[model samples]
Target: MTQAQTGLPDVNAVGLGAPFGWLAGGWRDFTKAVGPCLIYGALLVAASLGLTAALYHAGAIRVLFVVAAGFMLVAPILAMGLYQTGRMLERGERPRVGDILFVKSAIRQDLFILGFALFLVYSVWVEMAHLVYGLSTHKFHKTLPEFVHFMLADPEGHNMVMTGTIIGGIIAFLAFSLVVVSAPMLLNTKSNVFVATLTSLRTVATNFLPMLLWGIMIVALTVLGIVTGFVGLIVTFPVIGLASWRAYRDLVPSSEGDVAAAAG
Candidate 1:
């Protein structure tokens, strides 16, 4: 039966090591347009740092955990420029600063819809974090180091971290499954948000291991970037974005017939 007959989208499965290959591909793309890519990454990092400082200024350092997780939720929208860079590089065309920055092609209704969905998901994440902290009100972290020690060294705080991690992981994965392919796909195709998100979910289910590895790699690299005072994001952010574009391109087939070819 054809992919349409079987009621499946045109997607492919890959080995677990495929994500690493995608990362390598991203690095190549980055080198081809380092200046533009790095500039794009810097803009993102600046926003992140600004928001973080705002939170600190507001005496809400305790909710930094939620903010961090929320980044994973909304990051796809932030990486649109990087996706454009990848697209240009794939065409053997040099990416210009204005091309990636303005990204005139990305100004579409479907992309806005996708961004809205991510925003909703992020809102839910924030509410959940508030609930978690509200459950245990005995301790309040007024600073970063205090929050770290509370989460790492205290028993109740450890439990709270575990709970938040488990819950946040589930929500984060849902966001990832929805956006992994759909975000970049919507940028490149005329697909509606519903079809694009469905394809993203199906792609994740079909390539669980590789996608899992990919998710781990994303978190690891992002944490690495964050640890370096958000400096490393100048490189890691675009690499992950470029690699994610590669991942989406690899998982989604261009032709309906390719599904059968992949199944074979």
Candidate 2:
């Protein structure tokens, strides 16, 4: 049966260690275009730092977890430039500052649609965070430390924690499934939002184990970036971005004609 008929997109079977290879390839790409890649990384870090500061100023530090999770919700759109860089590398060209900054080819109607859909998902999560917090805890803490104590020690807070974690986990997985491959597909190909999204879901279904490992790696590095006060993101952000591109490259097959054209 053909892939199209079976409704399973053509995807490579990735090994358990495949994500690490992608990371290594990503590191190489980062070094190959160190200046531009670092600048891209810095931009991501700056944004993260800005959000953190805003949260602190708003005295909503307790919601920082929601914010961080929301950051991941939109991260694929943020990494379009990095995907372009990977494309350039694959085409036997050095990544340029302009390519890393403005991916002209990736700017299309479908990309916008994908972005808007992700934004909607993020908005829903934000609203759900409010509901979850309300249903989870009896009182909101005024200080960050107090919130931490409530989350860790209070009996009512424990219930909130359980409920929030369960609901948030599902939301996170849904976001991951929706964007993991579709975002890169939109950036790299002529696929529409619906096709890209369906393909992404199929890829996940067909390769659940490796994809789970990949998702875990992404979350771990992101948490590390947050724990380091967003400093580690200077490296982690671009690394993950580039590595995601590699993942897309590995999973999706190229058209033979396109491959031949590139070779020519």
Candidate 3:
């Protein structure tokens, strides 16, 4: 059987690599990984709900803002565990569900790096949105107050929001190009963060179109999960995690271990 058929890495695998055939093997891995994902998701939901409830009982509309902020803080950390669990499963190893809580060892560093990178991207996106809004407001300075009132009352406000969202999204896409593959690569390897980040940026630049498609798919699936109130996340998270491992295995150039094993 060919290496690809056997789920082995191929030397010829390049940018955009093949769809991981191991995705067919995912059902079994899903069974093994689902428990932890569900547990984690449940904990997140409970914490979020509890916090939101507390704020609401205190008569705070700001509770929604707090919940949103908390989610932004926790999502990346939870994602690290999700991704790590998939990696363990891919290696046919058992992974503890609780390992999600601890961030020691190489995994911790990698998670921090990823979290920091994500925070950077989020900060930039937020700043860009503010900048755009500021610019628009400035340009219409004399009418700004009236315009704001009109926007608040008009159905066209939805369109305005959508346009702003699309612009923010483009900015985020540009930022992720520097870190997407690198985050997982850093998690899986002992490589330095700078190297990992650069490698990821290089991969995206070289495979821009396919990577963009992959990004869109990820965003769509994630939004679908949100629409389902996170129940869909149990499945979507693991699938994406496995897909990421496969993508990383495909795109990042092989290391010494890979070469040695290939020679052996």
Cα TM-score of candidate 2? 0.91
The better-scoring model by lDDT among 1 and 3 is 1
Q: Model 3 off-target regions past 4 Å?
A: 1-28, 47-77, 106-114, 130-156, 257-264
Candidate 1, poorest ten consecutive residues by summed lDDT:
255-264
Residue range 8-79, candidate 2, lDDT tens digits: 457777788988999899998888878888888888888778888888889986677788877877888899
Off by over 4 Å in 1: 1-9, 256-264
Give the better candidate number (2 or 3) by TM-score: 2
**1-264: candidate 1 lDDT, tens digit per residue:** 456785545789899999999999999889989999888989888988998898888988876667876787888888988888887777678889998899765798889989998888888889988888778557677888888888788887878888888888889999999999998877655467888899899999989888988998998998899888888999999999999988887998766443332222
Our model 3 lands, by Cα RMSD against the true structure, at 7.4
For residues 150-259, write the lDDT of model 3, one tens digit per residue.
Answer: 45765554554566668766765765676566656655445567766666777777777777766766667666665576566657656665666567766765766544
Error of 1 at 23 (Å): 0.6
TM-scores for every predicted model: 0.92, 0.91, 0.68
Rank candidates, lDDT, best first. 1, 2, 3
CA lDDT, candidate 3, residue 227: 57
Q: If the candidates were sorted by their TM-score against the true structure, best first, what order would they fall in?
A: 1, 2, 3
What TM-score would you give candidate 3 relative to the actual structure? 0.68
